[model samples]
Target: MADRLLDAMARSASRLYGGEAVSELEHALQCAELARAAGADEELQLACLLHDVGRYAVDPSLVFDTGEPSRAGPHARGHHEVGAELLAPWVPERVAWCVRAHADAKRYLCATEPDYFARLSAASRHTLRLQGGVMTAVEVARLAVHPWLPDALALRRWDDGAKVVGKATRPLSAWAPLIRRCFDR
Candidate 1:
């Protein structure tokens, strides 16, 4: 079962990364690795690894494990809505919603909850437009239906944690045991 999950993830990562950057599989795996190191729960760790699984549904190109030269920011801007639509079918609604919204939390939080703007990346100071505009009120309203909003929000926080290069990202293997633990819980 896990093998199938990882395989499906490989496909999503391939297309969503915009013909450049790390394969979507690599990045999603990295996110899951990160969550595992930080002691995140199985579902959340699973969320980290497969957040963008939606990409597979939207674009099969992402399903491949191919590599390409990326122009940097396109991975963030190009994939979110498509990711959301695709994920709605394969995973829980909240996981898909949070994954879709991970890159643009500031805008949604900023408009609805001004305090959130302060939590945005310090580096984002120079790349506002480059990161894509914030999520719209309608989108935010829709995502609210996600059953795992709080968990999704935490996943969003860790998404940022997983970004720094060579930082101590936990390995995906570490979550295997954790995944089992979650079932017993």
Candidate 2:
């Protein structure tokens, strides 16, 4: 399973989102590096690494082809929910929850933090509009109580920063041990 997951990531590494500066693998590795630097537990770091896996898991044609409006929803089947479901069989509940909520975490931060929206990359900003935009006051208050919100928000921050072009990090193979360690078995 671990090898399969790594292979999928490698296969999708060259596929870039419309506005993201980094390829999918680079973003994932960078996010994992950020989580490790912050001393996050293995599960959180793994969550950061795989939060966007759904983009690879789903039909690439659905994600990359912009002709259909139905395919453009950021939280559609192409986003967090599919990734979380894919990881749930192997990963911790915390990791799955973080992946599931990372998109919402972005909305939460944009609503609650000043200048947070402005800090988003152009691609992210474009997707944010598709992702229900900023959270309303009520939505913000609702998400504040989620147990996984902090981890999700942290992952979101890492996700945002992981777009650095040409940033170097450990190879994808270097993460296999951590990925194996976190597998639920």
Name the best candidate (by TM-score): 2
| Cα deviation of 74, candidate 1, in Å | 17
Residue 151 of model 2, lDDT score: 91
Instruction: Tell me the TM-score of each prediction against the true structure.
Output: 0.52, 0.88
lDDT of each: 0.55, 0.81
Error of 2 at 23 (Å): 0.8
Error of 2 at 160 (Å): 0.6
Quantify how close model 1 is to the true structure by its C-alpha RMSD in Å. Answer: 6.9
Over 1-185, each residue of candidate 2 has an lDDT whose tens digit, in order, gives 77778888897688774567678889899999999999998889999999988787565444422223555555445367778888998888999999988878988999998999989877777767766789999999998998878899999999888988999999998998887676625
User: Residue pairs in steric clash, candidate 1?
Assistant: 11-62, 11-63, 13-24, 13-25, 14-62, 15-62, 54-87
* Candidate 1 deviant stretches above 4 angstroms: 1-27, 37-39, 54-78, 112-132, 135-147, 173-185
Best by lDDT: 2
lDDT of 1 by residue, 98-122 (tens): 6766656645555577666676555
